[model samples]
Target: MNIARPLIQLVSWAILVSSVFLVKALANDSTQNLSIAVGWSKPPYVIALNDTGYEVELARQVFKRMGYSITPVYVPYGRTLSMLKSAKVDAALTLSENTATQTIHLTDSYIQYQNVAISLQSSNFKIKRPNDLAKHSVASFQTATKILGKAYADAIKQVPLYVELPDQRRQVGMLLNGSISVLVMDVNIFNHLHSALEPIESRQLVSIHNIFPPSHYHVGFLNSELKEQFNRALNDFQASQAYEILVKKYHIFQEALSTH
Candidate 1:
């Protein structure tokens, strides 16, 4: 009937409309679910089971604004990287330079600071200055290696680094067990862990006053699509004063290590 060309055109238009609807529906579904990787323990920035833990709440609010339902996975800092590298997770709470994954995209600094060494209260190691640790063995996470390096020049001799602990609570464990003369950690994190993780004998610990290696913390994403969305959302958070509230809420950059 010589009607093939018109029929084909009509069919093509119908297919285009159907495809558009399908894409929109899929995108909508995706927006409702967001799964992220976070460490399982509390203290040093993230607290498990605490409604207001910095990393947990930050992830919840950030993703929620992007129209995503939050899925929080509790894992160690090292495993967090593994999850992102394998594309098993969508995002992570804290991103460090040590992670070194090519596929992971990072955003601007969401948190930043220096970590200090603390001794058990009985140890009497006063950290009143930076170089005071020239004769002590220091334990720290792998991510803290560079940060520690900036503080001590011949760091290998004075500051010995133990392997990264599974979580921040281990810093206290090492101190209690005498595995390390002192442990280096961000002050805010040190405080967070001090109050929430475990009950340490009050007389057994003391944190140094001197700070070391001022650093910045960042948020990370696995895919470019989510990365772009988070960056935009983070900017809005800053502009809307929510970032300030978060900083105060989490006490983000403020050091909480006062000799107690």
Candidate 2:
């Protein structure tokens, strides 16, 4: 046997080992990059990509602990659902149980949203129950009817003037300017929007009635494995001080709104 034959065999083995390692490293890198869709721009939840709100930060931290990186893709509320169904994104954030379909696997609820019926204090609207909304000119965010449940949808349908707007800021302006008798939205969102108004306007114009119960939100994923992974990561994050720090950073607190 030629002595060079053994050396060539050794070189081939080395090349094969290196190729395998390279492939594995690339696969691991791909798995670590998670693409997620974020629908709403509500502050303290999702302010922007740079100033990512509390909820966004929470998700980021959870994924970070799981050895994954998050790429947040902003879209409208309705488009977020479509993207998940089409598998355009690995996951969608801030989805409710009512909004997720059977094809989508949802992670455990990580946050509770306090939704309220708000109007200008001057209007003196009374919304003790869903039925009370039937008599008012109402405006809400897109898909609010479905996410809020059938009772809300039915009651809103009876109103002579009911519209769903994509822009929460516009809804606030309409409520303040007498275009809508009442606006149904999360209390935090109202606070965020109200903060932008003039000092006197913020003080005297807006009022909120705690008519709706709190809604729990979750992340929706196309893959069940990813959903389970997120749930475990979320549980871990919740048990850590990092979660508390994020909440404080975003100023996510329940502040009593002045109601008539």
Q: Which candidate is the best by lDDT?
A: 2
TM-score of 1: 0.72
Clash pairs for candidate 2:
none
lDDT of 2 at 246: 82
RMSD of each: 6.6, 3.9
The per-prediction tally of clashing pairs is: 6, 0
Best by TM-score: 2
lDDT of 1 by residue, 1-260 (tens): 78999999999999999999999999889768767788666553566675447667766777778889887887876677778787787777677765545677887776666666677767777676657766677766655654456555455356555445666677767765788777777677676666654565553446565556566666678677877888787677667676667768766766454552
What is the Cα-based TM-score of model 2?
Answer: 0.86
lDDT of 2 by residue, 85-135 (tens): 888998898888876667888889988888889977777677788888999
Kindly report which residue stretches of model 1 are placed more than 4 angstroms away from their true locations once superposed.
1-30, 50-52, 98-102, 120-134, 150-154, 157-163, 176-179, 196-207, 253-255
Query: After TM-score superposition, what is the CA distance of residue 207 in candidate 1 from its true location, in Å?
Result: 4.1
